[model samples]
Target: MGADERERLFQRARECSGHRRTWSEADRLWTQVIDAYRQAVSGSGRVDPNDRRQLARALWRHGMLLAARGRPAEGLATGREAVTIFEQLNDAAARDATDQGRDEALAELITAVLDLAETAFAAGEPVLRMDLLDRAVAAGLRTAGPPPSAGPRTREAMGTAYHNQATALLHRCLTGTSPDEDAREAALAASRACELRQRLMDPLRPLSVWEMANTYGLYAQCLTLIRDLDRAATVLDLGNRLVELLGPAGAQPALKLRVAATMLARERASARGGTGQRRWGWRRH
Candidate 1:
């Protein structure tokens, strides 16, 4: 197909991919999107920055879907491709931008790193995951700068990145040799994420459903790792309430699963506690 036709197809695929759908439908649409992107790139005589960005985004989404569908190796390859493209774009932007531009480039770089880290975690590459997380944290600090001037969207993205990193650390704490050190570090990262998310949505609004599901569940897991069952129970209760607010079963299957896991953890904590029951006395609705 021609470049214009390919772009149109990519757009349609992106729109289709965003809607609620069965895995088969999602997989088909995402594959189509990737195909369109590849066609456009091949048709272009010269590299187009916008086309590269679209392709990177498509690849990243496809990689996430692949990981979700239990194809981690292929997903990791696609995710790495996306990250490499994003990094190249950021490097180019870094060469041309001023202070604000620099911040934006750094933020984008941080995001790309975190995205790869998450993919690595899904691929069972814990060593690479931790290394990427460390790099992301460093990039995030630079993105924030002296006065902390990142926009709300950037801040939210960074917060979510921290949460993902923290979750990886928490997993290590659960399964690794140095539980105490890993737990402490995980708690610190989780707390930072929690604070940022709270700042993003507090008093006037609550976290977006996915953010609520992820942040609270992961934070509670960190608490559980630290043997703070009471606080973990409280966090799980908060997450459970978010699940109740979801209004229907299967509206967000992944989020529901996370919430369910949080509930199970709370129940286990309750069983092991001194009082022989949940401290919060909260039951899943």
Candidate 2:
């Protein structure tokens, strides 16, 4: 295609890819961009780094839609591909050129990795989730560039890691020989993440942070597991109160119910000849 045609095609693909109203449309646009790049290779003549970046972005969106729709494995595969291509293009960019391109690429990779972690944990593949979380946390903390600050996204990523870890531990608790120690550690991390979120959310304080409530509840959950009913009750009580203050009405009924059930379960466990609390040494982080 001529220069005019190529530019138009690229612009059209971008517009299509960015339309978030429908997932199917996003997929269609991403497919077109992918097809456009398929005919051109690294040394196959005139190549645009911008075009390469766009293609990666398209694939990222398409993969996101897939994951949202419950096709996590497919989403993860596509996201990995996008991360690979973007990393390449980002590195290939001239130093004279703005690092915005590289920053954007890395940001997309972070997102994809986080999504993959959540999905893996949900699917009971905690190993995969843990690996992704490890990479994300390390990168988030160590990110150094012209941008100076790691940005709010880094905190968000860390929060997500903690959330997924808590979930994986909970899954293990019900499905395996939980061993106490494992559950305690996960719960402690979850609580620390909640504290971090509170500090980060301070600017929006009074706006109410339901996510924080949820995080705090994770610690309460761990306490419940170890027969620390009083502490567990206190933590969850505060969390439920925050949930109420958030004014989401029905955003967390199920979670609240689960907490309530846990409280009742703790009571039953205590009544059933259970003595001596088990401190799995799961120090609250």
Candidate 3:
């Protein structure tokens, strides 16, 4: 195919990726996108940096699709290549610090790493998941620091990155292999994520009920892990409210919140005992 034809096919593939579709359809479109980009790269006598970056993006999308479709081995191989491409772009961007394109490239790199991390976790490779999470956090912090100029989307992505890290930490804690420090780290990361989510909130761009519920639920879980029962209860309540707003689809998470809240309250009560007075209060017989 000519360059123009390849470009047209790529654009169509990108557009198709944006719409809500079944997993099978998404897999097919992403495959087409990857093949188109591969053809374009093969036909070129000398590939330009722009063309290479486009190929990286296509590979990244295809890797994500593969992961979502439960093909982790293929996803891992493709994702690694995407990461290498983005890392080179990151270096180039750093050399020319004024170029906004490098920053965007780094952001996409972080996203790709995170997507692979999810796949790793799903595939029961906890160690790879942690490594990817650490890499993503490092990349995001290095390139997307302090998002006043990074805009709402960047800020939201940062919030998501932090949240993902926190959840990973929480998973570690739950595995019984993590030290006590893991719980503390999880709580801290969760708190940061919560604050970012709150900051990112805009009246014109309200989060989906599912997003709100998941964030709140994850934050509450961290609080519970750290034994901050009161805050956990409050956050859990907030998540439950969002889940309610999500209609019948939210029933499962809402039920989960209810169960977790009840368990947390019970644990707190068991720890506190039946006492009528405060800790400082002078309670007489």
* Whole-model Cα lDDT of every candidate shown, in order: 0.70, 0.62, 0.72
Kindly list the per-residue Cα lDDT of model 2 for residues 1-285, writing each as its tens digit: 443554566567556645556556656656765676654444568877666766676666667666766777887788778767755653564244355644554555566667667766555577887787766555545553322254454455566666656766665665567547766767676675766667666526643376677676676776677566677777776677676776665266337536644654655565575665543333231
Candidate 1 lDDT over 33-150, as tens digits, reads 7777776677638877777777888888778777777887888898888878777776776687665665665666677778778778778888998998887777666645422366
**TM-score of each candidate structure, all chains considered together:** 0.70, 0.69, 0.79
Q: Quick one: how many clashes does candidate 1 have?
A: 0
Count steric clashes of candidate 3: 0
Q: What tens digits encode model 3's per-residue C-alpha lDDT throughout 238-283?
A: 8887776777877656765765565566556656896632121111
Which parts of model 2 have CA positions greater than 4 angstroms off?
1-25, 36-53, 85-107, 121-126, 142-150, 202-208, 253-257, 264-285
Q: Is candidate 2 or candidate 3 better by TM-score?
A: 3
In model 3, which regions exceed 4 Å deviation?
11-29, 42-50, 97-103, 146-152, 208-210, 241-256, 272-285
Highest TM-score: give the candidate number.
3
* Pairs in steric clash, model 3: none
Better of 2 and 3 by lDDT: 3
Task: State residue 32's C-alpha deviation in candidate 2, in Å.
Answer: 2.0
